[model samples]
Target chain A: MFLKILYHLFVFLALFGSLMVVVSKKAIYSALFLILTMLTIASLFVLMNAQLAAALQVIVYAGAIMVLFLFVIMLLNLGKQAPLSRRSRPVRWLGLLFGVGIGAQIIAVIYSGFIPPAETTAAASVTIDHVARLILTDYLYPFEMISVLLLVAVIGAVVLARRHLVQGVETVTETAEKAGK
Target chain B: MEYMIPGNLVVAVMIFAIGAIGIMWRRDAITIFMCIELMFNAANLGFITLAQSLGKPEGVAVFLFVITIAAAEAAVGLALFIKIFDDRENIEAEKLDLLKR
Candidate 1:
């Protein structure tokens, strides 16, 4: 009973956090809300008995990816009140209508195909070693490719970020001199 | 647990919906990228949940790949964001009218 209740609670938190992430006006607050969203999703992973995936979700998405976002936002010095251009009323109305139409279609599809739910309980049958074996043997290619991808990304990000540093420095210096005189 | 709790899928769907909306409506490039990540996580959650119900561990393995891809995407994305910001002093996608013609 307690476990079931806990599961529902976590699921509620996950959905609420996701809403917070989307609705927040301040970009930094939105980013922080995403971290909450990721963490709650991690909790959901744990409930589903995906322990390894849960840990990776926190470490990678919440920990690494979000930190990069925060770093860039800070570095760019984005203002909280940055002015945003308003979209035309017709465009906004069209978008809303399209969204509602798609959502209604999805609901209709799901309603038309209902299946009997099976009672599949989480039995602690698989050990860590077993999981490791399946991963290394069956999914080795994907694992290796992902490592290469990360490596390339790291190098690419460095190069791109460096390209701007000189220009940013020049602008700062020019602005400083103007202010001093 | 007899009926599909309906709640299990709700969170994933909500996250995915938010991501789709953000990707469509947001003008900020960085926010769009973050929305993409949110969409990915929503898919990841569904994958793992289905894997667990079916007694499959391979789902977890696939999620690991997702993490890798997400990290790589963020790195390249942030880099591109920096370059764009330097060039235009802004990261709003609508302002980039160079390709409009």
Candidate 2:
């Protein structure tokens, strides 16, 4: 019973955080809410016996990714702008209708009894060691590919950001020239 | 325990739907990107749940790969957003119509 209550609590928090992320006016607030949502989801992973995933979710998502988001939010300095725009009332209503419709469809599918009942014997729990071994053996190629992808991303980010710096310098020079003239 | 799998699945679906709606409704590029992350997280939840139910480590393995890709996506996407902001002075999605004829 306690576990069930805990599960329900995390679920509530996760859903609530996601809603806040969507509706918050400030980008900083949205980023903070996303961290809350990620942490709740990580706890849910723990309840599901995915401890490694739970840890990574906290470390990579709540830690690294969100920090990046916050950095960009600060870098962009969006506070001076008007509040985030809201869709027109009719569009907002249509979006709500679509969201509800998709949700109802999923709930219907869940209740259709199509999902096989859980096996009587609990499945062997996955451990970090087992996942590591599987990655080294069966999934080695994709693992290597992921490393390459990360390398590419690093280079791409550097190039893009550097280009912006150069452009800023050029614009500053142009304005200075105009002032001199 | 019998209801655990389906319950988790329902939560995942709700999260995905919420993310999808947010993506459609929000104007801020960063917010839209965060919404996309939410959708990815929902999918990751479903993957982990199904993997646990089936007693296989493969799903977790895939989850790791997905997480790696998500990191890369965040890096490149934020860089692109910075570039766009440098050009336009704002990150509003509706105002980014450079490609729209």
Candidate 3:
């Protein structure tokens, strides 16, 4: 009973944060809201007995990704922009209507398809060793592929971020370094 | 105990919907990127919840890969934004029209 209450509270917080991210005027605010949402989602993971995932949620999503987001928002100086341009009022209302419709549909799905199953001892099943074994054994090939993908992404980012040297222009970081010297 | 509460999945779906709408509603490119990240987390939450309920550990493994991939995507995406901003002064998504001709 206590766990169920905690779960609902976390879910509410997560959803509220997500809404704030969508509507917030500033990019930094949106990023902060995202962090809040991520943190609450991590709590949800804990409630669901996914300790590893909960840890990763906080470490990866809230820690690493959010830092990158804030770094870019600062680097580009996108903090104070003009207020958002609004779509037509009717269009906005229509979108909201569709959103409510979809939401109702999802509720119906929950009632129909996701009936609660018989309670079991699932909490004792997913030990750390079990997940570790699966990764190193069954999912090893894909794990290796993800590493390769990361390597490629790093190279791609470096190449993309560099200014066109053929144009005889220094990139922002290069110019700043030269100025410091 | 009701093991399959469906609450987590509902939360996941709501978050995902927010991301989908945010991508269209927000003008800033970085904000849109953040929304995409939100969508990724929504999917991750779903995976973790389903794994726990089904007593499967593979979902946790998949969650790790998903996070790593999200990190990679963020790196490449932010770099692209930086490049675009260097070429053009702003990172607003709607204003980029260099290829419109």
Candidate 4:
């Protein structure tokens, strides 16, 4: 009973944080709010018997990914832009209307009993040990593929962000020659 | 077989809605990316909820993949954003029409 209340509290906090992420004027605050939301979601994962997921959520999503977001926001110095979109009211309203419409439909589906009830037959929790075994055995191929994807992402990011070394060196030497004359 | 609807599923829907709205509303590229992340988290929440109720570990495994993909995406997307900023001195999505012209 108490745990359910705690879970509900976390859900409320997570929802509020997500809303703030949307509504906050500044990008930095949005990132912070997002981190809060992630943490709450992590706790919700814990409450759902997904302990390994909760740990990864905290360590990777909130810790690493949000840090990357913060670094980008800081690096770009994206602050105090005109909050309002230049898009006319109608176009913007379309987005809001569609979002609400789809959300309502999904909620109705959830309540319409389209989904079957839980089995509750085995009742085995998804612990770290179970996850490890599955990843090593059943999910190994996809796991290897994910690592390759990460490697590709690493190379892609580095190539995209780095400047041409030859051009950089030429610019430095050109400046040096100008200074000497 | 008389189980109540899980409240978390509804919450997941609302979060996804908030994300979609934010993506459309926010102009900043980073904020839009954050909204995308919000949507991903909503999916994660739904997966975990169903996994718990259904007594399956596969959902949690899928959650790990989702997180990994989110991280990889953030890294590459931010780098791309940095490249855009370096070239244009601003990251406004609308202003970049070098191609549209």
- Compare the candidates by DockQ and give the number of the best one: 2
Residue B54, model 1: lDDT of 56
Estimate the overall C-alpha local distance difference test score of candidate 3: 0.82
True-vs-predicted CA distance for residue B33, candidate 4, Å: 0.5
**Error in Å for residue B99 of model 1:** 2.2
Best by lDDT: 2
Error of 3 at A40 (Å): 0.6
User: Chain B TM-score of all predictions, in order?
Assistant: 0.88, 0.95, 0.92, 0.91
Q: DockQ of candidates 1 onward, in order? A: 0.46, 0.60, 0.56, 0.57
Error of 2 at A96 (Å): 2.7
Lowest lDDT block of 10, candidate 3 chain A? A115-124
Candidates sorted by DockQ, descending order? 2, 4, 3, 1
Rank by lDDT (best first):
2, 4, 3, 1
Q: Model 1, range A1-181, lDDT digits (tens) per residue?
A: 7778888787777777766665666667768888988998998777666687788888888998999999988888775733332567677557656655654555455456452343457443334566688878988887788888889989998987786445435543355557769
Better of 3 and 4 by lDDT: 4
Point out where model 2 deviates above 4 Å.
A80-89, A163-181
Query: What tens-digit string does per-residue lDDT give for candidate 2 at A1-181?
Result: 9999999999999999999999898888889999999999999989988899999999999999999999999999977452545667788678878987998898798789876666643664788988999999999999999999999998998887765444435543345557769
The DockQ score of candidate 4 comes to 0.57
lDDT of 1 by residue, B1-101 (tens): 32223445555666777677666666677777777888899889866765666566776677778878888889998988887787778888777665443
**Candidate 3 lDDT tens digits, A1-181:** 8877777788889999999998999888999999999999999877766788889889888998899988988898886882454556676556656666776787678668664553475453466788899999999999999999999999999989876756877655566558769
Which pairs clash inside model 3? none
- Docking class for model 2 is medium
Report the TM-score of the second chain of model 2 against its true counterpart.
Answer: 0.95
